[model samples]
Target: MTWLIVALVLVVAAAGLLRWRRPAWYWLTFGVTLAALRVLVRYGSVMDACGLTVPAPRWRLTLARMTNRPVPGPRAPRILRFRVTRTGLVLRLKLRPGQDAFDVAASCDRLRHSFAMYGVTSRELRSGVVELRMTGYDVLKRVQMPALAETRPMRVPVALREDGAVHYRDYRAVPHGLVIGATESGKSVYQRNLVAALAPQRVALVGIDCKQGVELFPLARRFSALADNPDTAAELLDALVSHMQDVYQLIRAEQRITADVPDAEIAADIWDLPENLRPVPIVVLVDEVAELALFATKDDEKRRDRIITALARLAQLGRAAGIYLEICGQRFGSELGKGITMLRAQLTGRTAHRVNDEASANMAFGDIAPDAVLAAISIPTDTPGVAITGDSAGGWARIRAPHTTLRQAVNVCNRHADLTPDLPALAPFRPALGTLAPVPAPAVESAPAAA
Candidate 1:
């Protein structure tokens, strides 16, 4: 009997340690069963306490009274199905007559606390049914991307969502994106992940890094064009604008708009063009938008206006021409100067990492909920890559990009250098490789050697 007690104590101690250090293992070994039991036993009472219950109907009350039966107090949503996932549980519920998905979503925090879950999110699956996803632990604490699966064209899985789902950077869905974070906020790491993801694909990468070629130049092998200064970036932008016009002209020529032609054959965008004839898509990465916007002299002011205007035009029309913009910065606001807000408006996808102030978060999530801004600013210094991702449509989620070191990203780019596309208009800006020789070793003094 004493041995049995000792074994029980040991098991509990190990579980506690696992829960602290290896949450995923702990969840798989013990947490799942215990969580399931908790939900099954206390669901009804917990729902009632959380006010997620509807009063019994009048007819039911009348029938109970007539039959001399106890009165029904309230009705909680019926659980249609309960599913256990690696990260947490999914509960599909049938809403009570008076209840809707909104109520459940509104009370997610209460539900999360009552169920002892890490996080809870809800979405309506159908008219009367809603799906509640509960996370067993903080998935973002240690980012591990899920197993590879078939992905769609122009989509790259860049991060892990808080709910254990993959967060994809889908260019087709969001043609332009704005990424903002303070220094050492893992903004550069996120960009490296993006570049690595797109390296193997048949696409052209255009980099505008105004930091003296520090950030984006390392992965130059896979980039069709790279500009290390604002002047070159302006020229590159003009070249891209011209390339877009050329693509549009090609699409017009291939429209096949005759009355007898099928509507599907009437090409609109590059995707609709014949595979052999279609030009490769281009992803423009602007390392620091503020660099291009800041100006001191009259010449600098003219240059800044030109650059902003070119960027705005690209954001407005580049989508249909297979050109996408990824604008990254520490802060995106009117302080950068005129036309900044207009460009921000055109970027539908917003991602904010740890920012220095609330105003920076607001600049990133201008069209999203205020809560998103709050979440962005609240990110602690220890967590670097954690960010809030949202879009102009609405809603937001926390995501953390898998860490990709500079060397790893460079290796990836080198591995797929053959996939780099040739864009004639921007060929002048193509990064020159093997142009600089290693610095010669300094010679030792003969007198010092003799001594």
Candidate 2:
């Protein structure tokens, strides 16, 4: 009897040691074997001690039976099926006669938590089924594995999200953003992508390209107005401001006269105004913003000052009025002159592409994230479309705008063109078209035809 007791103790100690020192699979094998041996030797005593009992695996049998169910005509199956996947998991569930995917997702939380005890996780594949994925003990190490999946439009490359969806984080929420990049740094491509995406919507497009209309003229077909120089830009902006004022007045008029209108019937913005009073939301794109600041002589300095003051006012008040700015520039620093820094402060969203100088990058991301300036400067010249973006929330992200060409942007603009409106406030600032006329046209024509 004494020898038998000692042998039992030794066996129990060995089993515990194996479990502690070996892998889970090895421990499972050893434990099952030892338990089997104990059951054979001790018979009924061992069974009673462990309270061991075996029940038929009903779940496995039920699954098998469900799989064999015959399909009736073109109708779908009733049971959902799913398989675990490498990156995440895949699920395929057949909906019940009246059930949908949302039903399955509703119960996923409980299922996930229950499976967590076994180092397994489950998520709703859809309304009908769920997927179970094994989580290794060393889960953190597994996460570091090189990503094998290819980047798709639905996938965000950075840790932050920029999937181009018109959700809270995207166009529907922010409405506008300012992008700063030097020449050859791919700012134009980013602008092109943004315009291409937004053009399909009902928003009106406005462009101020001080590059002699070379960069944006092709897109004139879509743009309500395209200003080629500072003088024209000032006029175009003043028109937009007048348009904004009208929108505000409309809002105020609606607020004052309360009707038995439904919640949805209330006019909240330009989009919700009555058809007659509805002004389309304008997305103003400014290219080479520095041109709006540069002055060749002291005589022209006053004109530049007026332009700056107008832009600053727009940047400060336009957002709530539904006239948003998307200002692009090669440089946007204090060196640009007095109002430049003030203008930068009004731009809540910042995207800095590869810059020619650190100072330009600092101008874009300095007050927000100084480290992001370093990252922007380090971006390789070859990677023109890649940029560092920061928002008013102080969150930063890296994004690469898909390549876009000048022609594509022009085509987008041409498609959205509408009859331009005149701004009376800007009448004095409008550049004299006569002064821009060909020198020979005025001189020769005025001399009279030599018939």
Residues 373-439 of candidate 2 have per-residue lDDT tens digits of 8888898876666778887766665656556678776676556544333334434433232323555
Q: Given candidate 1, what's the lDDT at residue 100?
A: 76
Query: What is the TM-score (0 to 1) of candidate 1?
Result: 0.93
The candidate scoring highest on TM-score is 1
Candidate 2 accuracy as lDDT: 0.60
lDDT string, candidate 1, 1-451, tens digits: 9999999999999999999999989999999999999888999998999889999999999999999999998989999999998888989999989887888999999988888999999989999999998899999999888788446778998998988788999999999999999999999999999999888788899999999989999999999999999899989999999999999999999998999999988899999998999999999999999999999899999999999999999999999899999999998899999999999999999999999998999898856667798899899999999999998767899999989999999999999998888888988999988766789989976665564
Best by lDDT: 1
Q: Scored by CA lDDT, what does every candidate get?
A: 0.92, 0.60
Can you tell me which runs of candidate 1 are displaced by over 4 Å?
A: 62-70, 435-451
Q: What is the TM-score of each candidate against the true structure?
A: 0.93, 0.56
Where's the lowest-lDDT run of ten residues in candidate 2? 159-168
